[model samples]
Target: MNLSSKSVLVTGGAGFIGSSLVRELLREDAEVTVLDNFSAGDPSHLAGLDGSLEVVEGDIRDSSLTSLLERKEVDCVFNLAAEPYIPYCYDRPAQFFEVNANGTLNLLLACKEAGVERILHYSSSEVYGSAKHVPMDEEHPTLPLSTYAVSKLAADRLCFTMYHEQEVPVIILRQFNCYGPRETYPYIIPELISQLSKGPDLQLGNIKARRDFTYVEDAVRGAIELMKCDRAVGEVVNLGSGIDYSVEELSHIIGELMGYDRVNIEIAKERLRPLDVERLQCDYSKARELCGYRPKTSIAEGIERTIDWFRENNERWIWEVKIAPSERIWRKDDGC
Candidate 1:
């Protein structure tokens, strides 16, 4: 599991967290290969690491991925490829199943065929929707409230099954809300920042819902540490900052940070989920004990970093704005 001399494949390496992970791996001198279809991902996000990493522009569900893995002599596989947006999953459940669930199946098969030594499957805290208890841990009963959550949960279990039956060295990390630069999705913090910058009026849905927001860098660091921990095999670890904040509170904070005295808030019915999970706060004791993983960034610090990045890369941020509105609002009649 030592990555120093290993060859790694990071699926969906062009996306938000995956791109960050790719950069870290390259810095550590690992021979990296990235497989991304550019569906919800953009290759431009990975421009800095282009020369150091091999890029394969193809879908994870394609049989070609197996061949590519075998030819590349991949030592380890990190399955970060997924349809991450909840509302998009509601609008396109079949696509969600095809990409998140079946795409995971394809990657597992490819890993097996390539004799990849280890695999780290990225999962989400949404799998433990509406936390049945405070500080939700790996042992919490999973009750996914969205199709996206359900698909990710299914993939997480698939990794567990692969480890038990197929003997693949696979581990799962149920990541909480990870946010940072190059993340174009209209998640709470980014959405609030974008809206506030546009004007004083910010429209959203379910402001009272809370989430455990982990910095993207922290989540990526935790994932890398877990990949080197042999004891993590066949285990599910939660990656989070062990903090929670309501969307309402987060928006207000962003408004203040942006120098706005006050901001107008509006509730748009179309922005609400059909079955929204009210709250999520993680229990990161296992991650800390196992891999010495602790979030190094506070919420305020992380928000400031994200805001700074957005401001510096305003053009890229603005281009992404066009894709955001459609990406955020869920529609039942959209042929999911």
Candidate 2:
């Protein structure tokens, strides 16, 4: 279906990738309604967008969602709301399931009630845990390692089951590690950038663990394209760069870009997760075949863009960055 002039609802639209998706949908002339609780999302991310945008500070688990969907006459829904912080999940595993799994069920029920045409459920690559093989595909065995991954996997299965049982036109888009501007959390890319911005010395964990990082814009574009393709409904697709980079390599690249000839690397146990996925690499061939999707941004180019954003908006993401050691690790009580 064409997105032009369509009414779209983006859950968690105030977030990093969600905000970027909201911007792109507006560019397509789609009337956008953002439903976010601002738990991990920032209100300022939606600031200064030129479009028919409606912002709702609400949660996906709200009982009023059906009424809201009907009132707005939303044509499509992009579900991105979730408790995504990994370390925090260890502290509150139940919250992750509540938001990622049960909350998704609530949205699905609302869509069923409101007769919403389509729903693109944003899932995470963590559901696959560490790769059992190179270039993980949609059919990869889902052996999630952490609570966050298991919660996401539960949501994914919910979407798939809902599509078959309730006939809710749902597409599960499993997005790999996404990094770009407006990211609130202290993930690897943002964390490294934050540290490097301050000095050359870096403290990190599991530098050998590899991940396939996809630029936010590219990931959003892939989702939009899949939504536009009818064949993608009731299917799971992977969105990624089709390449992987180790954390150590990523740090060095960031250091080099920041004009640091050599940066001090300190591997601290406090930064390591007990149940960290060792490696992640995406196989997006299904996306290519179904929707003619291919990631357009390279890692270096994306990192440069991210660095530029952080440089211009230091106050936006600068905060007391926290990692492992359990004590310093982010908890659910820690206000996002």
Query: Which candidate has the highest lDDT of all?
Result: 2
| Candidate lDDT (C-alpha), each | 0.84, 0.89
Model 1 alpha-carbon miss at residue 83, Å:
1.6
Please write out the lDDT profile of model 1 over residues 169-249, one tens digit for every residue. 898989989888877746777778778777779899999999999899888989999998988888999999999999988
Model 2 misplacement above 4 A: 318-336
* Model 2 residue 223 CA deviation in Å: 0.7
**Model 1 ranges with Cα > 4 A deviation:** 317-336
Give the Å shift of residue 38 in candidate 2: 0.5
lDDT per residue as tens, model 2, 1-336 = 999999999999988899999999999999999999876777788999998999999999999999999999999999999987898788788888999999999999999999999999999999999999989999899999999999999999999998998799999999999999877547889888878877899999899999999999999999999999999999999999989999999999999999999888999999899888999999999999999999999999999998888776644443233553222222221111
In model 1, pairs of residues that clash are none
